[model samples]
Structures are given as structure tokens and as C-alpha cells.
Target: MKEKKSMIEEEKEDHLKSTKRIEMEEQLANPDEEPQEVISEKEEY
Candidate 1:
């Protein structure tokens, strides 16, 4: 049971890393179309 739990944890970590990597790659592949000012305005002042 402990071994299975460890495996599950590792898998979850791997999935998270993979997702973040993909997101970063996509961002790099395509330049952001939105302006920084617009983004800042939408966020907290």
C-alpha cells in the first residue's frame, strides 16, 4: 500500500511538471497578443 501511494504521488508530480512545461512551451511558441497594460488594468491596482 505504501509503495502504491508513493507511485501515485510521483505520478501526480510528473503530471504537474508536464502540464507546466507544456504551458511554458506554448507561451514561448506564441507571443502574447494581449498588451501588458490591459492585463495590469484587469488585475488589482
Candidate 2:
């Protein structure tokens, strides 16, 4: 049972990991452009 559980856990995915890597690449490609997340956060203030 533990072996099966471990296999299932290993299969689980972390979507944010891929998103962050893509974000970093985009930043490197266009350092001048601001990310929308930062803009939205600033608007919250």
C-alpha cells in the first residue's frame, strides 16, 4: 500500500513550478516589460 501511495504522490504535479520557470525565461527575454501580477498588486494599494 505504501509503495502504491508513493507512486501516486510521485505522479502528482506542481503546476507552479512550470509557470515560474516560464516566467523567468520571459523576464530574461524582456527585462523592460513588467509582469501583470506586479501591476495588479500595485493597483491594490
Candidate 3:
């Protein structure tokens, strides 16, 4: 049971890291778009 739980946690962390990496790649691909997106997101808050 402990081993299974640890495996699940590891998978979650890996998934989050991968998602962040993808976002970074997209931002890099379109440097101009990212700033506008960020500004709008901040305005929402």
C-alpha cells in the first residue's frame, strides 16, 4: 500500500512538471502573446 501511494504521488508531481514545461515552451514560441495573457490574468484577480 505504501509503495502504491508513493508511485501515485510521483506521477502527480511528474504530470505537474510536464505541464509547466509545456506552458513554458508555448510562451517561448509566442513571446508577444504571453505578456497579454499574463496581463489579462492578473486583471482578473
Tens digits of per-residue lDDT for model 2 on 1-45? 999988777666455567677778777776886667644665899
Candidate lDDT (C-alpha), each? 0.71, 0.70, 0.82
RMSD of each: 6.1, 5.2, 4.2
Top TM-score model? 3
Q: In candidate 2, which residue ranges exceed 4 Å CA deviation?
A: 1-13, 37-45
Per-residue C-alpha lDDT of model 1 across residues 1-45, encoded as one tens digit per residue: 999999999999999999677656655665664344344565766
**Of 2 and 3, the candidate ranking higher by lDDT:** 3
List model 3 lDDT by residue over 1-45, tens digit each. Answer: 999999999999999999788768768887877756865776899
TM-score of 2: 0.48
lDDT of 2 at 10: 64
Q: Where in model 1 is the C-alpha error above 4 Å?
A: 33-45
